[model samples]
Target chain A: MGIRQVANTEAPALTAAVDVRDLWMAYRPDEWVLKGVNLRVPKGQLWVVMGPSGAGKTTLMKVLAGLLPFQRGTVEVMGFRLRGDLTPPSRRVVGYIPQQLGLVRGLTALENVLLGSLARHGGLGPTLGFFPRSEVTRAREYLEMLGLGDKAETRVFQLSGGERQRVAIARTLMQDPKLILADEFVSDLDLPRAARILETIRGLVRERGLTLVMNLHEIQLVQELADHVVVLKDGKIVYHGPAGTLEWSSFRALVEAEDGRTGVAGW
Target chain B: MAEPGSLAGKGRDVNLRRWQGLSGALALLAALGWVLGRMGFFEPGRLTGGLVNFGRFAAELFPPDLSVLPVVLGALIETVEMAFAGTFLGFLLSFPLGVLGTRTLFPRPVVLAVRLVVAVTRTVPSLLWAVIMVIVVGLGPLAGTLALAVYTVGYLAKLYAEILEGVDPEVIEAVRGLGARRHHLVRYVLWPESANTVLSQLLFMLEYNIRSSTVLGLVGAGGIGFYMQVYISTLAYSRLATVLLAVLVVVVVMDVLSAWARRHYLLDT
Candidate 1:
């Protein structure tokens, strides 16, 4: 297995940053959550998905990120097949942060950020509190970029909600991922903090020229950060076009229509 | 927004709640009475009283022989060691199996296989485990230690599964996003979050194991129970008083320690 993997990696063209076709997922047999979700985002493109609650917006991200197994679909991320009609641990190329931001509370910002990179490249990083200097330096740099340099050593549980979100984004960056999948990361933040988070994400997208497919409620955020906007409703794309065409009214209508179905449009 | 009709509906809901609560209280009292009746609780009370016999027994235990205090101390220490060794064995062994038994950690078949093994062990009482060990090891503290260790693993495995299941998956998602390996997840995320609850349970189990070891000794498993049995069988009321006092002191200390640990780790204020 090691020899074959090594031989295959010599030719990097074997991987695509993000690829999906005919993706279908239904937690229950009675209904499909994501009906034929066909999507493709090459390296360095920011794609934002907009939809009301239960429209399979978050489901699409998870399926593409290889977090959820689609009943019938093919997902290839960064040349690694996340789920090609089957589930596998395809976290090699993609960094996925879900809506709740599953950050470790006991760890510091630096440790968390360092952990992200260690997972991908493979190394015996840290056992106890002791850490190597090089990794610690990299972790501090990532936190500094997120405007959290002073708070790098601070435990995550001690941080504010906004600070945690920034640290989460920083941790994702630590992977040096070709693609980032954020599922409604800004829904928990206030309007100003949400704007800051979007700016932080946009800077990362621009700097790395990476593909970012995020599921978010704020259409305004998409207009600001996304290159393309895909709106889904009832497991189907109702609107797919440039972010320039989106307006408050159409997005609001989708929200009002599905008001009773789910509590919020944010994943 | 709900309409005025919903508010009127809420009035009906309040009435329904009242009726349910009243009926539930009556049902509980009746069930208790029925169970007590089945147990023949009242029949024993109707029989002749033994107030005088009780007084004599109470007198016999008191003015206890303080001469055997050293012997009592040694037995008490053995009981503590038994509890310590048992809890340590249980905690360490159950840790990995608990992680395996968690559906969120391992695959379904893997979890099921481990669960079957745990269920078999849990079905038997700790005292039975002691008896089995006694047969093999032959009358010693080693038998009591083995029994409680097995008992601890069974009890902790079940509890650990529930605690692992109840862990904040959000934290898991955080580390997984960074692409932490399974071992990484366990060390960084699982160990920290579950440590408090697990510690509290360990302390409680330690207290229980100490008490259990004393009882297990009655069956030739070993520990202070042999002395207790001797006192009982020989009618050595004075030595029995010494043994009882030693057991009581140890139990009180264990309870106090358990409470202190809970307050320190759990309430965290």
Candidate 2:
């Protein structure tokens, strides 16, 4: 299928959907979590961030999503430059799916998806539970697109893990985001399900020309789905290029390499 | 090569240690008994004498004077109204305080200030509050209602803050990531998730307030308790028995209703 570009007034004519330059972050004082990390992701591409356990893949995603504050460096996402603080206005064009699939267990799938348009319906609309019929219809359409039309009335607690993940994706899609950051969004799903989810994500990204950056541990899945690949090790970028450019053996070696040895345990 | 006498000596040492432990326990028990006796807790003479007098009074309480049934029912209805009004007011006031007190929503200083107010209010019992209100508001159901409302605000707010704090952080994180404001976080995420728990706690507080409101009138706060005091002072055992029976019936009905509400409405089951 040819790439379909939807004109967005919010996003400028910028090629890079995400651009990070020498980013640095730390949870504690002096000790850094991300040290001198840099990346540039073009629009309409599915990028995979591959790393071992505690290799700062999630941290980088948070920094890009404007969830975590950085001690140093610049981050530009969805045409907004982020220094440290993540203001609500700057976050409007982004959709973030956390590792745990943060769907409210008590709310139905439709209600959960409707929460994505909360910001759009500002004032007392959300507080009074008054959603315009158009927004509700759009939410249902997103669920239908995600193959959850029949399960719209089902509470999230009653859904399986894979189903919950799909619900989370539908919720994100309802946001109408320019960039989507997913952290291990399908790690719990089986191979066929994972492949199907990736396929759906790929189709959406291409159809809408939305940038997709996700953290994945499965190398074969990454090889099949990722248009671009970034490998992080000890808070540094070990590899960043087109996914097809690297051999499987070399990519494995790059991920397993231990460069910095401080005898510190993985976070 | 060990001597037989050495093993026997070890056994003797064990026996001595066991005896020491037993004596230590005995000393502790004796100390506890001496303290309790000094506090006048084990006075069998006064207890037996009081029981004999109470048995005489109990015989007089039978065949309760049905003549005062109407008056007793009116006071009983007033008591239920006080409990219901107090619990409703408390619930209304506690809702905002609970939301503001959550550390996830507010800063540490703000959360701490809200918690300090809740703690101070909760430190005083509802009966004590009624007494204080009686002094301030002066002898009526108004005093009882105000007392219960203040007391409920303290307890319910603390309970709500705890529930808000215990909510899964990831759920909040997801909402916040979507650019949801503070109010949205509360209205959409926190309240819906904790609604069942909050409803259950409210019902429990209502049941407890009903029982407590019955006694608020002893301080002239207005209820059957004032009539009870009057009957006892005038040595009117039959009237007092009628009042006690009315209270028993009201409390039982409230208990059953609250339990039903909890099971059928608040809980999933």
Candidate number of the best DockQ: 2
What is the fnat score of candidate 1? Answer: 0.61
Q: Per-residue lDDT for B218 in model 2?
A: 86
What's the TM-score of each model vs. the native? 0.87, 0.87
Fraction of the real A/B interface contacts present in each candidate?
0.61, 0.70
How far in Å is the alpha carbon of A51 misplaced in model 2? 1.6
Model 1: residues >4 Å from true position, as ranges? A1-17, A85-90, A121-133, A253-267, B1-28, B44-52, B263-269
Interface RMSD of 1: 2.3
- Which residue window of length 10 is worst by lDDT in model 2 chain A? A258-267
Task: Give residue B250's error in model 2 in angstroms.
Answer: 2.0
Q: Which stretches of candidate 2 lie over 4 Å from their true place?
A: A1-14, A244-252, A260-267, B1-35, B43-54, B267-269
Q: What are the per-residue Cα lDDT tens digits for candidate 1 across B1-269?
A: 44547987788888989999999999999999999888776676433456667778889998989898898788889888988998899899888888889887789999999888998999999999999999888888898998999999898988898788777887775576566677777877887778778788888899998888888778988788888999999999888988888888899989998898788766331
In candidate 2, what are the lDDT values of residues B1-269, reduced to their tens digit?
A: 54547987778878989999999999999999999999877987877888899999999898899899999898888899999999999999998899989998899999999999999999999889999999999999999999999999999999999999888988988898887889989988898889999898999899999988988988888888888988888999988999999888988998899888887886361
Residues A196-244 of candidate 1: C-alpha lDDT, one tens digit per residue: 8888788878887777888987777778878777777888766666776
- Candidate 2 chain B least-lDDT 10 residues: B260-269
DockQ of each: 0.47, 0.49
